[model samples]
Target: MANRTRTPNEGLARLLKQAKWSRSQFALVINRMGAEAGLGLRYDQSAVSHWVGGTVPNPPVRRLIVEAFSRKLHRTVTHAEAGLPLAAFDQAPPGVDTVEGIVDLGRADMDPSRRGVMAAAGLFSAGLAVPVFSAPAHATEASPVTPGKQTVRIGAGQVEAVRRMTDKIADILDELGGAHARPMAAAFLVNTVVPWLRAEASDTVKKDMWATAADLVYLTGWMAMYERDHGTAQDYYVKALKLAGRAEDHVTYCRTLRGMSLQASNLGYGPLALKLADSAAEAAPKAGPRLQAFLMGQQAHANSMVGDHRRARSLLAETEAALMKADNRRESIGGYNQSAYAFHVSHVLHEGKDLPGSISALQQALKVMPSNERQGRVHFYAVLAQRQLEYGHLEAACESWARFLEDYEHISSARGDEHFDTMRLRLKPFRKAQAVRQLSPRIADVALLKA
Candidate 1:
């Protein structure tokens, strides 16, 4: 049956219906399975339309559909039972059999609700199986263009093989995020994935490709933004948005916009940040709870950036309320929580003349953040120092600033340096005083920080 030719989306549709899933949820499940198989493909209502219109997936993807149902229903699926064509063996991409698209493709699956879908023991099991590129060649079955006499037909088997390639790419990207990972990741995105997405591919493959592209674009932009390339970061964000839109993914869209808003607010574009945040919040009401929470949190950050203390507070309170009402499965949308949100707002309050609030918020944020992230720790410390400085706690300010430098030396992350640099500038008047003068050696090495 795996080698027979058949069109089986209706069979899939029927099976999903029995599970009481809405069309959207079914699409989400399908998209997630593809992502889990490591294809990084996403689906929305538009994808459902394509499926209903006979846009049958290649054999490899069809197998993924079968697998999704099998797992969900706790039953095995036969190619024939799924209504897939027997001759679909040749319908997949070459070397696509393995699920490598899981890198970016599995991202959406990170949602809390899907956590139980795969067992912890199986986490790295897939990574170990397959020849890494065990997929076959001649697998362009997922291609959108019709095959002609001269163009050989792509079989389901061949299409399944291409999964190996995307999986390899995902692995490579993951490995490159270390000490020297940033530049390499950037090169991979610019010189490779971007070109692939722009090239000709099947709609199925294109959807898969674009989701991967969005992930890479966002990562590159984030690293570059940290390096202070605001313009480049904005370009990446724009590209990511376009790709995410093509994939019809709302969560990635929200994430890209919120990430950009953070940069804007930090760079003094408070008005722009506010606008972006407002738009995000408005669009979020229709999304998943996690996505909505994420958008709301960003909006809170934007309001605080602009010194809208009252507005920020109100939004945060609303965010907290929303979060409290949300199921545990939805928490993944806004990852860290109101702790990070509150901390950010507190910094704004401190900067805007609310000293007591800032100190209190900083203290709270530090409690929740991981101790070893280094960079975030420094920012929290710097904010604490600033609040102390503002309140005329000269000795305490000096103590906090000294501790900030300890974490600063362990990592070259720019955000940490920027915060410390700001503290240095603010502490200038007190420089010649006895306590500050004693730390002259530490102050002399300002090269690592922003001036």
Candidate 2:
């Protein structure tokens, strides 16, 4: 049952009038829009009447109503304008402190039922207001602490341990895939990291811990992103921002923003991605060439997608120049390398409609990619095969797909699974080709293993 008030929903009634929609008309629109999103809503005039008669819709239904009105009015609409309540996750920010919010969000994410509700609650916000990185340093003790939980004293050693664990998790993500990595990260955040954040430590140690925790949370969010649980991913990203802000760690803060930019680019929000990338670059320190390359590479990809190819090409050149000056060591948070640069080049070229150029870049990426990065190899080969097939190089595509299948079979990744399915579907028509014919038995063995 929906929570209710004795008074009518004057705000919704006003919007309905402004949209020139009758109760039945509004209900029909709501049901139709809900169906489009896979929700089986069958609301009618009476249900609309109840909503106007002081009953608030469920959280998902509230979003549906907002979407319905937004469509009818041809403008953005807000819950405040509709007189609807914000969902719990949405309410967490502004009203809650950073540490408490992180703990709460992590705990809910850890629970199966709560996580399902969060996933269904529409946690992904395209229009979410991202915080500026100019956050002033705040005292660590300002965060609300959990009562009755025992606090442990932490030092530089504890901070180093988190960094080591984060590196280990990164290795696992690269070697095995996020399916084998993210759970460990989440458990460490909830079981080990959070307590240290809430522990007895010198102010300097506490800030270090917060910054370290932010990096871990950011990685967790990145994994959630590749796993396609975008809503959950956004939750982790927001917590990462808060933690970064609390520690005044601009490096991690900008890195998180860059991560958000990549997520936006992946979701086809080109303009949004560019805005986020620009924000990261603007606030980023002159850390080193590696950091510059990392930021510029994303900016290049985003600009390319938005048809600003001139700017994109310049950024790409700058990225390559900067990367050349940097050391070969992985630069921690989502390290940028020749392989990553080559992949970015592929994205830029593909967006420019240069299919052959894109294929060549993907090949370069594969050639330079570290052999231990099985997870990345799976995606690289899958995309390379797809482009090769699209470019009418059937035999070359078959060879690439064979490579994809090899790395894919050894990894446990949701995206790798998707590509596996796509490879089979894409090859079905080419079964008569000699290369594909030769690859058939291998494909079947991998498919059966996956199944």
Candidate 1 lDDT tens digits, 1-451: 4755434377656776766666687678777776655677777877765664556766656666655665566543434445554333255432122112212222322232332342231222111111111222232432222111222223333323333333443343223222233455544543445335334655566556655556666665565466455554565666566555556555566677777777777677777877777865664436655456567777877887777778877777776667666665412122445556667668567646778888888878877765444555676788788778878888888888888877766655556657766876887887788879876678677543424
The regions of model 2 sitting more than 4 angstroms off are 1-97, 104-118, 145-150
Index of the highest-TM-score prediction:
2
Q: Encode model 2's per-residue lDDT on 237-282: one tens digit a residue.
A: 8888878887889889889999999999989999999999999999
Alpha carbon RMSD to native, model 2: 13.2
Best by the lDDT measure:
2
lDDT against the true structure, per candidate, is 0.57, 0.82
- Clashing pairs in model 2? none
RMSD of 1: 18.9
lDDT of 2 at 240: 89
Report the Cα lDDT for candidate 1: 0.57
